[model samples]
Target: MKRRRHQKTRGDMMKKTLLAATFAVWIFNVHAQGSMTIYGSIDSGVTHISNVAGTKLTRVDSGNRQPDRIGIRGSEDLGGGVKTVFQLENGYVTDTGAQLNPAKLFNRGAYVGIGNNFGTLTFGRQNNFMFDMVGKYSNGFLLGSFYAFHPGNIDDLTNAGAYDNAVKLVSAPISGVTLGAMYALGEQSGDSARNRAFSLGANYAAGPFKIAAALSDSNNRSLTLGQTTGIRTLLGRTLISGSAQAPVYSALATDKVRSVAVSGSYAMGPALLHALHVQTDISVAAATATMKSSELGVNYRITPANSLNLGVAHTSLNDMSWDQLTLNNVYSLSKRTAVYAQALHQRASGTGTVAAVNSFGYATGQRQSAIRIGVHHLF
Candidate 1:
């Protein structure tokens, strides 16, 4: 009888322990639940340029209206109203089916952060404040025409600049006002200021009027294609021929860059009017070159699914200047699909200057024009 009683007690203890273990697992599941989502966008166009190295060409291009990209984003509930989030995005060329940046798997974005009521703070490769403010408000994106941006996207207000090894903070909207800041470390050995970058931005939106402003400063940055792509041209050693495309990329290791951008928009019934200005200064070998651009644009809605956009701008680099005009029309097939057409012309004046649109290669002559039709899909 004693032996049977002892066995019964041991069995009851084991059952209680098992039940406690199961209850703990159930509690963990409730507290740490999370959700994940995948998303992407593709844009392709058939385009013709009047000049590139003095040659007229017609070709199918990728990412004319917007870059092709795929991304994954997720958030995990950490309890206590706090959540941790992450995003990974890859940019690619739709026509060639190749990665936009051969060196990176996730060239567009890769970041992780935590959030709460105060706002969100993220770390790793991320957008600069200029992109958060002016890029979002600029007609280039709002009108779905990359050519509407300034030549070479000199100020990087349209996201041509990407800062790596960075930390960013964005505040929650307060009274229709939002503010953001970002800092990127140089990561150079024994020198903290060699290749560092920082930016600040502010935005205000109330009803039909919106305004945004941003400024960025960099120290001893690299020579980059478009200021974002790390591809390096042989500008340092090779003597560029006269017929070669002029230097439009970011500055070299001995150079410093500073950019300021301001943009505003107002809605008037079916039309939205926009104004934008950008100033960029690059210090190279103790010589500073300044470029300034000013633009006016409007988007008119013909119907709920069709719209037209017009943009005109002038950019000056000392005695050299360019004037640009663009027209963009878009028709929506659905919430996630659209077909669009764009036309652009640019005229250059001043000694040794050639015409070049933002996305197109340089023209050998003083004038350049392009026309494109494209389809866009988002998923």
Candidate 2:
């Protein structure tokens, strides 16, 4: 009897051990189902500009092709064809290692939302819908491969084109077409419309052709009295920290801004062609001003690792007009790394427009030129 009892006890212990092991494995599998990922890119280059403030300048610059940034993205499956998602991104300067926007930690993007079979609804600081659609047709996504933009990126299609306290939505592509919209709260104490912002955009892609259209508006953009010398001075500083592009009008206290743009691109074999047009208006307490701009560009892929980009843009506001041309050659050392050389030339005519190339400020004469050699890497 004692021997039989011992055998039965041992067997029971083994069964319990196996059961515990199976339970642990099941727990591990359940935990592994959710995923989070961290991703980003870094870029830097050497640049030389002729006639910035009447002097030649050479320095190290960040993001000649694309802005240097780091971001974290996470997603959790909630079952029933729905998921929860979040993203946080930060922008920095490679040369100085300074935050792109000093006021906010995740200045580039920060959003949380849910996604279902229908679409996505997100809330937080985010890029406008117009910017999202225009990226498809703007050369290399925007600003003519980052060499130059339309006289201060007047259409607000370039970097840092985000809105605060906003809600945005993106619909899944249905038959190669998608739509996006966004509304931002100005958050002024008493007046809801004081600094409100909103945008709408649509995009379509089929075969080798793509096109997009967008419209955006902002009201009562805040401006620092000390930093903004005049309407043009403040407008030129739109990309800098504490400044925004909402389509301001006059040199006096500006109130409202609006913009409309359409862009398209066609890819043919090794060559790609792109075109864009934008019209922006600003309203101030004193008067209203309108600016219109157009751009045409082409990209040729010589090899899987080598490419050439060229672009030309023209912008006009009242009596002021400006023109810019850019050419860049990019050679990829690997899938995530590249070395490039670029040249840019710009001219300003008409009465009020000064020769300004991006953030370089006013050129000495009506014409200015620049050259850059740079490297970029993705992670």
Candidate 3:
């Protein structure tokens, strides 16, 4: 009887220990549950251009829809409503698996931050306040890369094109509103004031109305292309003055650039409307000018997996003007995959000028109209 009692006690102890271990695992899963995820996207398409200067109707592969990318992100719970997070993302070419920009690795985004109930503070290369505020309501976001506004003409102002090495602070949402501010350090060797930029932005969403506003300033940078006049002999005209430079006029003065924008959106059921007004000022060393741009768009959901978009924009330069119209259709194949088609038409008000802005190459002002069909998938 003594032996049997001792064996039973041992069995009971083992069962209790197993139950305790199971409970501990459940507790850990509930409290210490954090995750790291890997994600990526691949976008590619075919494009056709019309009205080339010296080329016939050319059909080529489009590199605009989605430059391929891979990314990894993670978060760790620090208790008391705080968390530490990090992200590393890089862009590449899906057709060749080559780095997008050979000069830099992880060219898209690389940042670390702390997040909590208050807000988030991040440092490293990231999107600026203007991009966050204005880019969200862009027609490019809806019409893909075929739209004239995809690049948005901000490359010459900020480093990494649209993003920069900066520190950003975001405040928590209050009454459906949030605000962000950012500053980029020039970090020059002796005169740390050569290439500095700063921005402030705010976003608010109440009921069915949403609004955003932003302001940005950059010192010692040329933001927009200007016109250059030179005497040339063309068709027996003795001192012909025309736009002699390409997209970026090389001989013009260099100075600071400032930009401000306001945007708003409204959504009801399956239809959404958006509008934006942006102004850019060029303070040249000798002459100053301003550019104004405005966009209006609407999107309608035909079904749970399909959407239709239309947009129009007009931009007035110092000496020239242009208008663009875009039409797009998107069909979702899955939660993270979609196929899209876009058609854009742009009109210029000059004798030999076209409203063309190139994001990946330097062949600006060479295309008149373009159409694209593409697929985008995210994982």
Candidate 4:
């Protein structure tokens, strides 16, 4: 009788343990509930710019601190130290009511990923490591957006930067250090190297200082002739003799483009200092050339709601040189709204130099100047 009783007790104990385990799993799932959010920003400005085709131009422009955008982002907990994340953002011009890129929606960002404590792995359209690091650490971009980018945006440190069909990975910060990498497919059949691109980078942040370094490499992949690609837009009018008549890809023939850059910032009391340097090398079937860009700037917080920014930047492409100075001020009306004013002066000097103010396009002379007053709101 005692033996049978012992056997029954053991069975009962096993059943209790199984029930407890099932209850624990249910609790974990309940606690891992997912969440979603919708957010966006709108920025507009009145801009007066000069030295374009021997005429002074003035107009209403969109996006100063940031491009006008509407986005949906969310995360879903998948239990056991894993989650699903997604973001879809679109850019637009507030004044004209047109999409920033007429060819596609979500021109800014569209990505989905799985993430946990280890890191995040995402897929879809994204930006290169060089653009991500420089935008965060360079004063020209951090303070003034397009007004602060290097000439022609040769280093791709502005709103014009993006990569299609990409995979990106960013490691969780460990001990004030973080690392990220990205690879973009050129999508041309039968030629894997035609438009493939890749980037690697690392960043460190400690106390009031932050620094980042990145490297990128890309190739021309389009098979179609004469369709303007990223490479053509970046090197416009700077091509070697007789190359302009040829399609950019044919003239360069799968040109290999590489770039390396470093940027950093330091904070002291109410003032912050920022600096960056970028170097680019382009190699093609016939010739190779190098471009170098540098910038130094400072931002001072005059009060809780007001700030001032000043910066000087220079870029050299082959034999041409461009130098610029900018002053900007911003005042906050609320936590999500602000107003700003900025002034810019640039000079291009050399035998064939022309002053170009990035998004403003090429100027008629060696000197160019611009002024902008704008407002920004976030929701």
Candidate 5:
């Protein structure tokens, strides 16, 4: 009887151990299945302007130094090293709690795709190759809002809006390199010639050096309203005479724009060097013109909690040009909280025009300069 009882007890112990082991395996599998995360940033600051076209000098408190934004991203594991992924992101004014655009909810990025060791295929509103490749390398990526360079002078590529109704495919990283391309549907039922764009890009990284190149082209129909007065007359005449391809006063019932950019970065210990060169061409009705810009920057890590950044860029329109210099310091209070101050000085040279109010605030035919300082935060 004693032997039989001992045998039963040992058997029960073995069963319990096996049960616990099985439960542990189940838990591990569940944990490895997938995850979803919520992330975003809230940045706002006060800006003092010395001169704003059609407005008096003033100081205004504004939101979106870095552009307040929120995003939801997730991924689900599938068998065979494949996964399903999606992201919905939007921009808003944190101070006012208002959407940047009431018309659209996910104004920043809204895409769904399948990703795996083979790469990712995504659809919906997403960033273009130029923005992903060249824009990311600019000093503006670090300056938040106080810097005039926040969005690079290629306003036509960055500001016209994120690509909508688009489909994109990215190749798996191989030998430390990846390639991507995208196309927009134009959304026209029959005539697909109204407004359409397409882009392609490739990036390679090896050791401490990385390089990226991209090209994008867009076509749109434009109508310009002519005003026969003052500068408007001069600009209108220039547009009509084909001397300049100004967007105003000229009816570009059809317009085409192309951009090319190359960016690279090199890292050495706590110091890094970055640079980019971008060129854009616009063809509208009987007008064709080109704009070129370049940026060079350096970043130094002073400590675990602080860093210093300096950048310079030169923008030119057919020999006429302007240069901008920026200096910034960032101090981190925590992983999700930080404070920064950036100062920018822009000067115009040659016969280049600056401060036009179209998109990048770069106007043609005027020489102008300004400075800005502000802060940014993320969570």
Candidate 6:
């Protein structure tokens, strides 16, 4: 935990140091120059998990249907089809009114850049293409809640996937196709590539169908794994107290890590179909770990105000395997508010592995389940 905290702290500090100049324009008030907007969402709930090292527990949860966050973003017209753009977003804990990440005030994103009709180029702390492309086309989107994310979120579909000190380019849709690329600097003094990362993605949308694909590679601990993926999963970590924790899914720290994924969604009348596949590989020093995950799901809008989601996923990490099932129901109170209930179950097999569902932590048994009831609001 301490090591992970320090890693985020270093990333936040470096991003701030590297992008201070770019953000000056934003500080001077871009709103007066053009258009600005404030936006936010809050999702809080009560959840029950069947196992946490053998004891069942119920508690309050935040960011279930959506992340709890508030942000300000704006663009200043530079004329001739060009513009200056910037955004600052932060996440908070609904239960305690605390920042999601204590390392920085804008843990979600802090970036400034230029945009044209064709595309946009941005710099600073941001998310990778993997999160952008895969998320838009994956079953995870229809599920509309973190509870339905695959076990361990090994594929990163449900992870924050944030990168600091990053430069990113995203193209506007052209003939239904959008392209994206990103790179994050490690900024290490002696060695240049110690913690560098890069990612590429493409997305296509046409009427009722959409598809996306992404590729990513990183060195050391450059990329922030999803909250569920953890930092090191292979042998686990040694705590500051000198105690050891058993490995959860198998994300061993390595010199190099690579990931590839593709996902698609189709809308048919009031029903939606979703499918996705993800592959992750680690090599060079330490031990090699490979993880593969896939999912298929469907979402149906039974009524304008009611919807249902069902999904099943499978994951294989080296010698460990996990299978999960989830069901969710939601009722829209209005365009910006909704109430939901979800249930998830996971079955684990292989090499001392125990089942663990999304955001419920670890389990001591081979079977684990969770149920949650929540409300989501946006403004």
- Per-residue lDDT for 317-353 in model 2, tens only? 7777888888988899999999988898988897544
Against the true structure, what is each candidate's TM-score? 0.85, 0.84, 0.78, 0.83, 0.77, 0.85
Number of the candidate with higher TM-score, 1 or 2: 1
Reference-based lDDT, each prediction: 0.81, 0.77, 0.68, 0.79, 0.66, 0.81
Per residue, candidate 1 scores C-alpha lDDT tens digits across 1-379 of 9999999999999999999999888666745588667899899989999987689999888776777899988888888878898999899999999999999888888999998777788998887877778877676777788777776575777555778898888888999999998999999999988889999999999999999999998887554333321122323422232323444444445368899989999999999999888898867675776779888889999999999989888988667789988899999999999999998898988876778787676777889999999999999
TM-score winner between 5 and 6, please give it. Answer: 6
- Candidate 5 runs further than 4 Å off: 1-33, 54-65, 143-161, 221-254, 350-352, 355-373
Model 6: per-residue lDDT, tens digit, 184-303? Answer: 999999998988988899999999999999988788842223234322345343211212354424333568878899999999999999998899886646566688888999999999
Model 4 local distance difference test score: 0.79
**Tens digit of per-residue lDDT, candidate 5, span 1-379:** 9999999999999999999999988767755787777788876554444334434343434442455788989888887999998999988876578888898899888999998898899999988888776666666664334353522234333433378888889898799888999998888879796578888989899999988898887778342312211023221234333233433444434377778888888989988888888887767666765668788898898998888888887776555566777777777788776676655556656542444321224334343333334456676
Query: What is the clash tally of candidate 1?
Result: 0
TM-score, cand. 2 vs. native: 0.84
Q: How close is candidate 5 to the true structure, as a TM-score?
A: 0.77
Worst 10 residues of 5 by lDDT: 227-236
Give the clashing residue pairs of candidate 3, or none.
none
Q: Clashes per prediction?
A: 0, 0, 0, 2, 3, 0
Error of 3 at 116 (Å): 2.0
Worst 10 residues of 6 by lDDT: 235-244
For model 4, what is the error of residue 375's alpha carbon versus the real structure, in angstroms, after optimal superposition? 0.6
